[model samples]
Target: MSQSPHHKSFTARLRAHKIFGGIKPAVYKADALRSRVMPAPLPGNLVLPLLQHQGQPAMAVVEVGQAVLKYQVLAMGNGPLSVPVHAPTSGVITAIADSAVPGFGAQVQRCIHLQADGLDTAAELQPCLDYRALSHLQLLALIDAAGICGLGGAGFPTAEKLRVSIEQGVELLIINAAECEPYISADESLIRERADRVVSGAEILQSVCLAKRCVIAIEKDKADAIEALSTALQDSSIELLVLNSKFPTGGERQIIQAVTGFEVPRGLLPVDAGILVQNAGTAYAVHNAIVEGKPCISRITTLTGSPLQTPKNFEALIGTPVSFLFEMCGIDKSQHTGTIMGGSLMGIELDSDEVPLIKTTNCLLAKSTGEFPDPAPEQACIRCGYCADVCPARLLPQQLYAFSRSEDLDQLEEHGLADCIECGACAYVCPSHIPLVQYYRASKQAIAERDRQFQTSKQWQSRFQFHQYRLKKETTKALDKKLPGAEKTTANEPAQPFSRDQARDEIAAAVRRVAARHSNRTAPSSAKDKAKDKDRH
Candidate 1:
């Protein structure tokens, strides 16, 4: 929800979550938000990626050319970390193929292309007559079934997040309405039009959270949203905190520190700190899923930037192409060179406007000529410490930049590179114009690759250790095998684990396999060349 200083009485409580560090940049919301939100019909063919959320792509449940209804389950994912993908409207599945994803290049994701028949037919939905009547698990199951996720861009499955919060004994529920990013007002629009729904969703989440206190953390500049929510929660026990209008002030950790004066520890979630930060858009989505018995297939996306004749917010389908929004705004699709997702400071340039909207897509900015002029070539860092000063996570960007340049993971982690929110505060203030955020992104990806490999190896090592533990216990009994005539069908003998010597040998075999895999990847030279090198050596 948009936050403002309308509730002046709550200012004292708001001061508790003081602003930490952030940088201000040019905001382009005035022209963009001037035009109110309008519903954009789904494009000619909706291209829905099964991997809209933050886990494995949902497995397709329908075959090609099969007829489906609006809100019908196109794919299902029951994994703890995944959410299902649903059809946006009644259509036939035309193709399920790899397609280009927005914001990234050279990588293709599996997408379900649906050809709309204009039927607008919706599937039958089973609604919970009274949400209060359902148990917490039942509500979670409903949310999971609805494929609801963090609509504020993280795309983390909402059910899993709520379940984790409940499991971790989360105490405070901080509803994030910071909407601090410029030119992106989906949450603001939702709050302005449907603050009641947002509040109702918050109440439901609070019930599931079993939280002792609830806080709506929003920027004080959002006067309308603040007034709406102030009135909405007038008789409620929740606290309304109108925070400073700082860039990235709506960031998870920043808002957490701003509201509760608690800094989220590195490599840990906000829940670990006894807090659960959720987007206002997400809460509004939860309200829609449970109260309306609707599946998530559409969202409010800001289609702004200068390329279009008219820039405004559109309530578009989940898989509608960016070209559709451009056409809606009467802009030529070919001129979308700087089509970016999200706001200026943190937005990623789209390789093509054909990229379809996803649950996490909050904004689509197609810059017109000279809107975002090219930056000067990056110069060397001068150690001015300005990047450090503006860093919201308080990590040393210059140091991270140096380590990332050298591809040093140890120092990067030592300096807390993972904590950086990539809000571009450092890069914004840097005189060098260093793409520090990009470097950090690269570093994070690299570290993640290493962490994945390390985890696999650690699991094998754990298996080996467990085998050894069982082998020692096996010494007390002839657990490996019984003598031919001795103790037939003895039930008291302990169930033995894998043999330790065999386990050790298996581990050795695994090491060799891993080494061979790495060698095959890194050394693709011919056998002749290898022999020649060996002879030379």
Candidate 2:
């Protein structure tokens, strides 16, 4: 973690421009960083979820009992919004059923279960060392086929994002190495080992997006990672920026504002501000895809907590169960209920250790009862405005809190609730520990549901209107038909009338339909009554 001679001046330049409103909590990641990342052993069962990416769930291609090799496509999605799902190890598809896979927004989803045979086989891979020679569409297709997505917990499809940014003429690309969350060192450890790949990946992304400049934004406190990146980007034009370390500074909006001093307008994306932010791990994955001809099958995850024998990092494959890593560390988990997926502040607690790791799983914290106790019972908000003071989004969280509790979605949006990143900055600074993020999440979910219902109602209204229009057109055509030998019939002449039998049949059918409807409404599920009715008939 030696500093270059220019490190003093380089540090001062970034410090001169600082972001507003963030707290610096104690980062307990020293032990994890002390050791290099180790490859996690393949568990007995690997559960690959179909919907790992942001868009729709990829359709499963392999059926139960089918054999698959490492890096083979297990599922494929339709279009630009999704990436393919690949097998991590050579295995037989033992089951493909509804199941829980970790790293989603704290809920269970469908998964494809695989049983490894330990052979570690691979399918045929089309390696392209000359990505620069490929056309834009061809290159994007390659990235899509490789199943690449954002690893910074956003889980957005990388190819789709790059495609849109390129179309929109992105000006700046920012690579995030600012592992600002406490107890998370996956990105830092990855950079420490593979800084070259991260830089090269940034170059690829820059070319894909056609950005004017690429900058690697790291925290000033991470000296080792900074030094490593400095060496890697020395021969290149990419700039290494060292900013003050603070919670939520690693967020997309916050990082963009910190680096370029441009506040992304509310309800707009970072690309809307002429900037694109990507994670260091995502950059590394891109490099692996183009240069090494590898699909995204594994990610560097930080494994740390008090219950474990040692805290360290692991390059764990997707679908490795959380408890398997705990067992690998030889930990005593008797006192703990389950495990937390990410960091202490933003991570979700899982009641069962059976959850398997997916992309965006940066840490597996097996906290002891004493080390990671439950949040205290919610205390009443004191109306002290402390939450508003530390909000990085510059949002009035106090107002959002009241609107969310009251289920007032209209008021919530009017007061800028959507602008909140739920980065826990407000909750972190709350003196009453009100879990402000939870309230916002619930309110947003409610609003989304309401919007969905409204859209459905609109669709139904349109359908009804179309149906009425069709009926009117048919009725007019029938009325305007000329009668036989009446080519001289006047324009106001009456149309042909229904025959007597036709009218009788139509009335009888309507009567039968009404009678059937009434009978169904009054009928009870009794076999004896049905028999009695049949006998009476």
Query: How far out, in Å, is residue 235 in model 1?
Result: 3.4
Q: List the residue pairs that clash in candidate 1.
A: 17-258, 17-259
Model 2: per-residue Cα lDDT over 109-196, one tens digit each: 7789999999989987777778788776776777778888889877899988988787766777889888788989999999988999
Best candidate (score: TM-score): 2
After TM-score superposition, the amount by which residue 433's alpha carbon in candidate 1 deviates from its true location, in angstroms, is 0.9
Residue-by-residue lDDT tens digits, candidate 1, 1-537: 112222233323445456567977767777666767789966778998888878767889999989999999999985888889999999899999999887443458998999998988999988766899988788888888989888888788889999988887777788999988888988887787788989988988888887777888888778888899999998888878888788888888888878866666677677776678899988888888898898888899888877788888888998998887788898855555578888787888887878899999998888766777778799999999999999988888999999999999999999998788889999989998998999999999999999999999999999999999998889857655776455544555766677899889999999999999788758778988779879989
| Per-prediction TM-score | 0.82, 0.86
- For each candidate, the alpha-carbon lDDT, in order, equals 0.83, 0.84
- Give the range where candidate 1 is weakest over 10 consecutive residues by summed lDDT: 1-10
Off by over 4 Å in 1: 1-16, 103-106, 332-335, 453-537
